[model samples]
Target chain A: MTAAGFPIVRAPAASATDVRIDPALVRRWLVTFLREEMIVRRGMRTAVVGVSGGVDSALVAFLCAEALGPANVYGVRMPYRTSAEESFRHAGLVQEITKIHDVVVDITAAVDGYLRYEPDASPTRRGNVMARQRMIVLFDLSAKYGGLPVGTGNKSERLLGYFTWHADDSPPINPLGDLFKTQVWQLARHVGVPREIVEKPATADLIRGQTDEEDLGITYERADRILSLMLRGYGQAAIAACGFRRRDVRLVWDRVNATHWKRHLPTTAVVSPTAINEFYLRPVDY
Target chain B: MRGAKSRPQPSSLLGLVPRRTSLDATGPSVELAVVQCAPRKGDVAANLRRIEEAFAALRHDRSPFPDVVIFPEASLSGYFVEGATVEVARRAETVVDELARSARRACGRKVGPFDVVVGFYEEQDGQYYNSALYASLGRRPVLRHVHRKLFLPTYGIFDEERFVSRGTSIEAFDVPYGRAAILICEDACHSLAVTIAALRGAQVLYVPSASPGRGMEDVEPANVRLWRDVLRVAAAEHGIFVVYAGLVGFEGGKGMSGASRVIGPFGDLRAEAPFEGATILRVRIDLGDVRVARAALPALGDLEANLGQLSSMLARTSGQSVPAVGARAARRR
Candidate 1:
């Protein structure tokens, strides 16, 4: 579908050889456009996505650019003092590639400023404070621009117990909520993200030296492979059969199984015969 | 060789013919009548009269007055009444005085006897809700329950989130003939609603919908079919009976698909109504059948256990339960 009827702006694939859109990818892209129209037609103005210098954000930025236009899309890159120079460089690379306007706000001052007032916060708590500071900034910007803050967290983050709720993660809109990390990479390449940025190690960059895979103690390639099997209703034996160690399989299972609540809305016990959310979400409109 | 034994077996035909085995007490079978109709837009008076007329005809003809009559979502006001304030108020009728008068008049003027489950817009505690009123003749009509929609879908010609607040509750309650449950249109798609109803021991699930039927320009017929099938799966999984009622005819330029149907505990369609005009379907449902099916399959038992796990997981993630040192550090907001 062309731009006349569709709102998708597919970037030139990584190379001329890979120009064709896979049938599955095309189907998903159409669904994405439909979803965006659903959001925009409801009167939302713009979208703000956290640019984490990772494949997830890159794909999200591209999709946002396609759905809402480059002018209607904004990116916020919050890098701490220890943040990799590549974080700033790649974010700029994506902005130049996509031509979406962005704000490079440094949150070190804000994070340190707040921490000085509250001394007893733990390392995890402090890390969360940094994550939430970025969100607060994004939301403030969202309100200013009358936009929705789009989430960049992929399915891997959601499945592997990687996200911090209401802090490092959680957004008003999640475009890539259903895609895995591997799929994120595939989309990033298809959307023409620079190889330098796409190949870089994934990280929350909460602390200067931290990387996500290091913190989770597993590589994304292995993690995604394990998760794919798990999602298919496979057990530990199948995971082990796929070359994942028993402990690694157990860890992935626990992460997904234990953090199940992150995937759903709050639960309400049945009290009346006609309970909303108990049987279904009743549409208030006719 | 079998002549001697065959002669003795011939003495009792019960020993030869395959018998219909019934597990529980078989009571005197009573005809249960149900009216499924496609209501017009803001034509509350007309819809009420139509229902009255249908019931009156049923009684006079001795066709059997429906024991229970269910209408579609916001059937009185029709679904898409545009203005926020006027539309909300127009649809929201409490029905204490209005429905009582209608019931008495309906019995005398139209139907000789009947009970009703009518969908309407209602305002309570200064909050507007998509509500339903259950009325019975010769008795104070029970309000039954009102459910505000939970997921306000803003996708594809839908802007419900703009006008309605999300409901925070999921429940089921008892009605006269059996333990009955009700769910609105979109509620029929979500598993949580059906699971909760089954957990509460509801024997029959009633869904009244104003689903956009075929040729709405924007809406598809497939979505309607999907919702209908999902109802069956939910009913079978929960070991409960489901009665689906939908509104037909065009309202606010959008068509309402009126493929209303009823499914047994095993996901078999017991009855169905056409997509046009008002209809009254009477089918006898034995609660004992539900008991027999549930006893044989015992699926609801696992649903209960799964629900417990779901709750604990929710409590754990929300940090609603106070945690120790490690847990406190992870507590967000």
Candidate 2:
């Protein structure tokens, strides 16, 4: 039986006659593909979403639990030594409330141990190392349990140079890439993310007592409003009207503009006679 | 006074009040034929006439009439602009006017509530855009809602960026039967626009393309295996209907393999047209497909998480660290 409550209709084969296409029908087809291909055939599809205990990860964990069942969704809480105790607590509470698989991996030991080889590392360099370590931990869990890793970064984070390279960026899927931080909160509430996770101070919790706004020099509410306006094709003045500092808004814009390469597949030349650009395929095996 | 119970409730200029035709708990089990036409090179008038004739033949004939007709990429102007000027690239108004007239006429003839979607080369302020027009009785012919091929295929056989500007907006509007979204040929390959439309609550996706290729007999053959894999995966994941209306027949010596097809909400091939010439395909879509898919997998509910993972991958690629293979391996254990 199909997931849509209809018996699965397997066509014998594609005939030259099977070529008439309707756009409306295609949408239904893709949804069905996701259900059968990813959920059923894949089997025991557990997923891990790295939660900073902020709205984005919190919301993602909640939704993954809903999609894969609480038992199949795993929540990984990776906190650095500088991370606030509350961030860890909130992640734990979110896991308990949502009933998702939860594990706490403290990376301070591994990071600090690695940094001993190089004592003169700058804060930014150290931060990047810490972020990558956290990703290493999450993927380790994914391998152990057999699932895909989910990400929590939003358009705001992607646009603001707010994430670490090769760290939180790499995931099999990202549910909130198009959404702004504000929109993430809306979805968080809709998905019943814990109130603590929703209302907590937005922080990467990278440095001791650090917060995202303090590091970026702008609050998410302000940054998200600016980003929303910009994405809708508005100009600088229109974005500034949203109460964000003009410099901060421009910074976010430049970050998104500069890092656009990270958002796409590797740029390959369409050199082959029949080589279509941007349709390159890579095989994956588990 | 003669009994007026049978008289059509005095027609109104403002809008025709829909009569209470028996509303079925399940929507009409009616099949819809979606046809894509590749207008002769720069011949808008011929294209309009061809569309009119197809509409007439389908509507008047005892054979089944399609609920909607779709046209290929720039089918209005044949997707070719000779002189790069506004006068040369200007969209012929005849296509829009004729399409609206056709829809109104079809409704009047009770041709089963028809709608027409056409693509054209639109020129405005010295800039040319690859645009589409959706004409129906319930709504006016809307031409500005264009899906300019976002990822312009500047290489191989495609040079879209050189001729057209990219479209920024993603729109899905309400149709009588369902909310519909449009993505032109190259747009379909990218997940961004499709995901945007899905997020915006569109239930039907229309892909109008002038896809070029040969091998009408072997194109997307079931025996090939990979195309079927693609079909099964794309349809089932999105939980929405997808209709591909591709241009067929020979144009400028290049064979257009019209492998137009409709995939059901559950990712099943509902109907398919031939790979050559103009062909018509019809299939009935039940809205229940989406509901059922959601209920069975319960996966769509976690759409945010799924998208978040992709976004994270995007973030990971930003920095210099090799995408932690260690991370991928960890998720498996």
Candidate 3:
């Protein structure tokens, strides 16, 4: 039985639906993890977060303000000229609610300057450039303000490889990295995030009228549930039997397998008996 | 010469000394719970509140409540305070009174009375000691036993000797669960202390430790493995049950290993908590096993026979000086 007097229920081997989380316990765990990772392990008193007006970034900013004082938390909003006005407004709402130090850096010139040389550049290239530019700004502010840059990407996006490498995925500390996108929404509501932001359509805001579901061809709710079942070693057949479409299960399974490289360190050819991070290993805190 | 001859012969040769049978045979069985909690550093009230919440949670679930609840060493004020002031070291009586009240309030009328054993920096007259207080709660609370740490570790990452005064005595005190003894963290490192307590009729040894986790691998921490070996050997050798309650969480950038466990007299692990986070490890132990194990081995009986001889040998060696090693070699040549 858990601390809440609820017996922990386990799914049978043939079943595929056993992903339940206690939000209160998860909140306590995440808060403690953030406090320990930032203050105790990294010796940082301040945190910097990139708030994009999305649920994921909004939740990260709120958690950072809760872990470290609002004065110590800095929220940066990086918007290109073509970014949605609603996104900017939502970011402002988060800043006001969390009461964190806010900075707005318009990246229209930085992104457009790089794109001028390649006017025929694809949308993906432009989106990647914008994401990297925002990261550079966030990191510079982190150095100037003596705060660690916090990552806002969630587990669902990470498994789907829906982020730019070394851009949106790189941070010294990440509180929401382990939580699924659906779980992030759940925790956002629990932490009193703005309801408008929580209910907003998930998007990258890099291009006009582009939504995450439209790009991925699957909803986060369905994808998160499929990923949950897949993570528990459930086969595609088992997942399909659990009231999920067979094609959706197969798509998520293939995406997770194809993007396995994004989740791990670069593979090194081992010549020595003990390689770094293999045998002669130490924790990042160490 | 006549008086010496009339004195009784040593029990080793004559076997005239009647062996003291195990008291555990007649003692009642005990249920014990060890709490591995992450305490907020130097926050006494918050730590107490955490303990209260755990206790209330256990009772509300109607789980098998333990007869004795143990917390980690320095759990009230935390460990590794460089220069603790008098305000940091709380009065033992006050903490005990509060715990007793909380325990009674949480488990009142539904369960049998239980005792709480917790570690804290205790303040007496102008001096402080790293101590464990055992409070037995029934109609009211009673401070049953207090054991100050005997050996203050002064090695790497440990400057306990510089911070707190050392206790000078080893004893076994009677509690609700027969004769039991308390040993703070470093005291468990000394086998002689455990031996002395076992010899003094302690059937159960409660070791409250604040040992930090040390290692680089994903397996059990080195300190945790070492503590397990220590507790296992002590329990098996002395034919006593051992309960080790360890603190968890980080303080001053150091991580604590929270592998709290209960070991039976046969050196078997009854219950063990994980290496991280907060957990309550509970186990039911039949005190009769202490008597059964000792009756099978009878090492305590052998120690009783040789204790006098060992004492005399130590006395004689202290009174005389041995020849130098070089001189003895030269004489032999």
Candidate 4:
């Protein structure tokens, strides 16, 4: 129905255009979020972010530098054996602009050490090993440098289950979890991120010529719109009616539905009235 | 302590004639402050020290000290405490005495009476209730009133009803400034509580809230936007001053937006704190505005008279037993 509810026809509540955000307000808000979460709650003065030369990590590095001083933010670049060389150059661009502390730890030997035992491992299995190895290095660096690791995942990647289940989402705090990938681009540009890195295709560097949109079977623009609409209680038919392809909408919806387990802590069976996670709930930092 | 200068006789505050006895049930133009501070989760001693720092900050900033200061709900213990409610909960009387002692010690030789309205988890008997206390500190310490939160929001990110027992009543108790009532957080979201306060001749409604900011689809946090609408409507329709004390800082990953504000009887914003971290919002509120607004709009007056006409509808929808203190407050009116 329209504003006045008549069952005959309905106007789309929101379309892809509604995905725009106020970048200045978001920048200020997330800056305070990072500062408060790190300094006040965790009692840390530094943030360690694995800068992939991607927009999400670049934006988080900029925010971390602004929240704590530039000297306090550590931008670590962990490239795999077959990783693109452009990833480091782009991360260098972010570091030059942010003037953050830089550290580079290559995971070729560590990931290869684990993969040597499994010679027939596929690219997906090898990618998970590389990703998990990167997490181990960043966490150990956090302990050594006294800086907490900050997450760089965005809403689209999270909802689509694009990132590794445990390795990528293991950070203690995430400031960009609520922002979509397209919105992340909007924020990265507003925060004075270099145009070269912001315009680059997002990649996990799992294999040569591998891009996120290619693996996901949809563009971030289309997927973000569908996810945004679906989040507001829109169904597959309703979203497709808004000029979205039924196949694309179904693909996005299926990914979101299939990944519900990835977004939550491990589920436990309830034997009695109270279960570990069922009835026992506590606030974070508890 | 500065007592009401125009008191005609020495009288007990309770069981007074239920009418607007003095100054339209209005009183002197009072200086008020809302202490919007963040309490650490389940740490009352640390929060008490935080409250003391807020008091010191207030004394350093303002002059002609405030007559009243309000704090956000669960200011002693943070919100979202599920199984820890019993551990964090405290007796209202004991907390009031401790608040009085702290206030006196902070004031140091500067003696003046001021009322403190603070929210906490209350452990009375063996039950736990989300409660707020209004007590005097400084010259003459007195426990004036206690209001248990009537509405326990149990949806979305909230699971309040699961951990704590719900309060049964909405009552407007007598305050020195005028007859005022306490509505803790979600309690003010309901119009019935505000209407009950207006019916009981309360000119001020003290609302202490600990709301996590969400819905980033707007320029401001959506929770803050909706709260402004709720409070403005409550103040304008009821012809009462609405003092809102909001919690600041993050609990878990949830950001508590702090824009502690005061709305006048005419629905005009008097003062507001920033949305950043903790800050004290102080403003002067005239109780006579309550008399002026009620006289001009007169909606509460109509509500009182026409409520009997809607009794059948109410009797049908009144869910449980006697609305304990709200019914008593309405009966007095």
Pick the DockQ winner: 4
In model 4, residue pairs whose N, Cα or C atoms come closer than 3 Å (at least 3 residues apart or on different chains), thus clashing, are: B1-B113
Candidate 3, what DockQ?
Answer: 0.03
Candidate lDDT values, in order: 0.65, 0.63, 0.79, 0.83
Which portions of model 1 show Cα errors greater than 4 Å? A1-286, B1-32, B84-93, B109-113, B214-220, B316-333
Ten-residue segment with the worst summed lDDT in candidate 2 chain A?
A17-26
Model 3 off-target regions past 4 Å?
A1-18, B1-247, B250-333
Tell me the lDDT of model 4 at A130. 87
DockQ values for all predictions? 0.01, 0.01, 0.03, 0.52
Docking quality of model 4: it rates as medium
TM-score of every candidate relative to the true structure: 0.46, 0.46, 0.54, 0.90
Q: Residues A54-167, candidate 4: write the lDDT tens digits.
A: 889999999999999999999999988688889888988888889998899989999898789999999999999988888898899999999899999999999999999888
Model 4 stretches astray by more than 4 angstroms: A1-17, A268-275, B1-26, B317-333
Q: Candidates ranked by DockQ, best first?
A: 4, 3, 1, 2
RMSD of 1: 19.5
Docking class of 2: incorrect
Best candidate, lDDT-wise? 4
The iRMS of the candidates, in order, is: 12.0, 17.3, 12.0, 1.8
**Model 1 per-residue lDDT at B294:** 68
